[model samples]
Target: MGKSLLVLENLSPGRNLDAYMQSVSAIPVLSVEEERELTERLHYQEDLDAARRLVMSHLRFVVHVAKSYSGYGLPLGDLIQEGNVGLMKAVKRFDPTVGVRLVSFAVHWIKAEMHEFILRNWRIVKVATTKAQRKMFFNLRSMKKGLGWMNNDEVEAIAADLGVDAKVVRQMEGRMAASDTAFDAPVSDDDDSAYQAPANYLEDHSADPAHQVEHQNWEEDSQRRLMQAMGELDERSQDILAQRWLSEDKATLHELAAKYQVSAERIRQLEKNAMKKIRVTMEA
Candidate 1:
């Protein structure tokens, strides 16, 4: 008799990977005859249990494929889970009439999901994208052994072998060899050797505490000077400057001209002169 359906439902894939694998592995693989029969049932009869058995039997194969992608630094469990999902998709779509093994058909879908996961999670800076770059990201690592840097001949050879441009190979090579460096030096640099850190030579004046404070004071002083200069103007000038320059509902030259009963050209001249005076006062 088949295993109790209720007992099988208790199985959690994440509780223990080993237990999950062992349990799924215990589901007998279909023989050629058995596979044909079960696949036929799933394909035509739409039997859910047959689909379940077909999926369960292939879990070990998914684990095998997941292991090959171990260098990507993503959690193996997550990769396996993604692969399992792909496997199910394959099972659902498998045609028993075509007469191919389920594992053979599922391999493409399983790797596709795992590849997407790796591309997303592998690094903050995405090293690879595009169909060609994706091919290079995985294979190029293996090609680069003993790395000071690949010489031009080596780059050309790798490019030729991989069916890609030499320039692309050079770019991928540079990305792989590169490492992230901090903008500031570490706190523990006490010796003269600490001068080697990037922070010593590449100074950022904008980030300096003293400079930042001075900048704030200068901005405030400029604003005060501008306001003082505006105070020197007549009431009409003050209103024009405030409404035309400062307030949220800014007054245009035409609007100010209509209000003061002058040509738009005259209003434009007054506004320009006011800006120049403000600049001179602020500089002083």
Candidate 2:
């Protein structure tokens, strides 16, 4: 299991959030030597405590990155929690031998987690699932800062910057601009706008008399075959089949066992035999 994430639901954002920010910021930045030493200990010795200290010291940086995602309307604490998970993963994989600072290497991982969290919760359904779409999704959100729609030059410029075709950029923008609405209307007394919803236009083609009769005939034929197959079993087997297979919320082996004063194993065996006999009879 992954690390359990912290939730923002319990945070009031009153005095407690202020205190948390102050406390985390006050944690002295690890010196170059100190960071290397801790990272090495965790890397070679597998010292979990060393890893924990490294994560804690970097919590403030996560806060700084999470602040940029505030406009997403998600809980700040949740964003920070996702960022923390990314930080831990970076710590576990970091190599001080690579000749790069830990924070510099960790920035990509931190934003990746935060970006996923925002995209998932930003809409009722996901807008982007592939790598190409993910690039377009974020680029379009940034481009939407000013307007009803983008001008031609603006779209081309964004396409060039993101290395996608201008036509693809326009399509992505159009998708992002659309909004979702309920399929059905609310209970309303006003006749003027009541029929404006899609529910009024949705057709139930199966309500036709010919289709209804066909469906009824199919059900009757299936039921007749089921009864004929069940009759191939003995009386006790039929009762067991009815209770275990045909009942709504069919009986469990334990329930059948209690009813017949037998072990659950015996009930299961009988049920299995009854089913096999029915299947074989139906096949014949």
Candidate 3:
């Protein structure tokens, strides 16, 4: 009962789809008596072996269902793998007393998984999110006859059939019609076409030559002022500030206290007073 029903032993659809399909196809269909016995073993005794047998026999069905979703442009092997997951879930919950064949019960789960995969991988930006939108998304694809956009009558008819607003259908149609573009120009693009890339248009003003020079000059002035202020501090205070604030290996108050043979609190007070004078001098 605790073990997995789906036996995915090196049967990666992504790695080698043809071989995986052949392997699943080779698993024989279970007889009714055999199905019943396995179901009983799973339901009553929580037999993992029986669950595995039941799943193995029905893998062909998952493959069949996954094939229908090939139009979404997803890898067929990935779809089959997802459907197998759904089948396992269905088997894990299947009861001997359900009175329906495992295929009938498992169809929903299998299709649900496939549908999720399609919605996710079909686009970088999701076209469908809501329950209503999801229903419309799948239906709209089938309803569409060609590459051309749907007309007013077609939109109205689809909306009526699907029990949603025509506006929603139009929006989803637009989303499906839209294609993703890379931000930067492609390597193969010539200089003539390169200007069309978003990277060319969306320039960062902060990195402009004029702005870079202004920022660098301002930073240098600030650092010069900070150094002049530090030079005004007493030798002990300047050493503490340099070790604690300016050094790559910053000295702790306790470490400074050990070096100076003073209490940590005394070092902390000296650091604080030196910082206040530096800030005042820099601001001036």
Candidate 4:
């Protein structure tokens, strides 16, 4: 993991996505026989060289798959990198006995990684979270005819096709159409425009005395509950919890082990049990 991160850290896909794409494209695709040989060697013999070759040959395919997600407004390089990670994962799990080509099996994994990346970075507020919404988000983008808003008929068609309500389709449409705005007025804004910013008109709930008192009560009650729970624990359990979690400079398992004259694993088990007991007591 460390080695992979170090290698990928030097790769700036956003700097020159075209150049990176061209580089991956130049890598040769493996023939069916060649792929099988590599897959068999990796699967049966656990050959790292075979795995490396398999991943190298499929780098171009990752780029190809990444291209379809270009509409998400993210850099092509980032998408391709994410796809490459998916490809590597697929390669790791490739089964020679599956009776299918590696690319066919890998497409799902590759697209899944790219989809996650797109959803995470596409909007300030997530546009799609549920499995159904994710399916609709991708399908809706492709189904729409043009940049214009979908008409009533179009919305109904999309709703029926995606197995969702028309209102849901409209909601997603509105979310996609929305753009991010500054929370405060820009430096160049005049007095008139400054008042239009969210900061100017938004209510400050923190300043409300009722809210402040309620928050303070909640905090004090939580602390009281925690102390009560801690008091319920045995001396050893209390010490373990306090040293491991509540201390400014926390104690390590080995250090605790030495102090208690117990194995580090035993210390870890005690720590785990102590936490579980604390949670149970607090909840009760």
Clashes of each: 0, 0, 0, 0
Candidate 3 per-residue C-alpha lDDT over 32-136 given as tens digits, one digit per residue, 9 for 90 to 100: 999999999999999998988888889889989988888888889899989999999999999879798999999999999998989898988999998878888
Instruction: Go through the candidates in order and give each one's C-alpha lDDT.
Output: 0.81, 0.81, 0.90, 0.87
Cα TM-score of candidate 1: 0.62
Writing each residue's lDDT as its tens digit, candidate 2 over 137-199 gives 877777665867888988888888888899998888877776666777778637888787888
Q: What is candidate 2's CA lDDT for residue 193?
A: 82
Predict model 1's lDDT versus the native.
0.81
Better of 1 and 4 by lDDT: 4
lDDT of 3 at 276: 99
lDDT of 4 at 127: 88
Estimate the Cα RMSD of every predicted model relative to the unseen true structure: 5.8, 11.2, 8.3, 12.5
**Candidate topping TM-score:** 4
**Model 2, backbone clash pairs (residues 3+ apart or across chains), number:** 0
Ordered from best to worst TM-score, the candidate numbers read 4, 3, 2, 1
lDDT for each residue of candidate 4 in 237-282, tens digit (9 for 90 to 100): 8898899889999999999999999999999998888788878988
Candidate 1 residue pairs in backbone clash: none
User: lDDT per residue, candidate 1, 155-268, as tens digits?
Assistant: 888899998899999898777666556656677867776787787788777899999899999999877887799888778778888888789999888889999999989988
| TM-scores, each model vs. reference | 0.62, 0.65, 0.67, 0.69
After TM-score superposition, what is the CA distance of residue 213 in candidate 1 from its true location, in Å? 2.1
Q: What is the RMSD of candidate 1?
A: 5.8
Q: Candidate 3, 252: how far from true, in Å?
A: 43
- Candidate 1 Cα errors over 4 Å, as ranges: 1-16, 25-58, 73-75, 85-109, 119-136, 142-148, 158-168, 178-207, 249-264
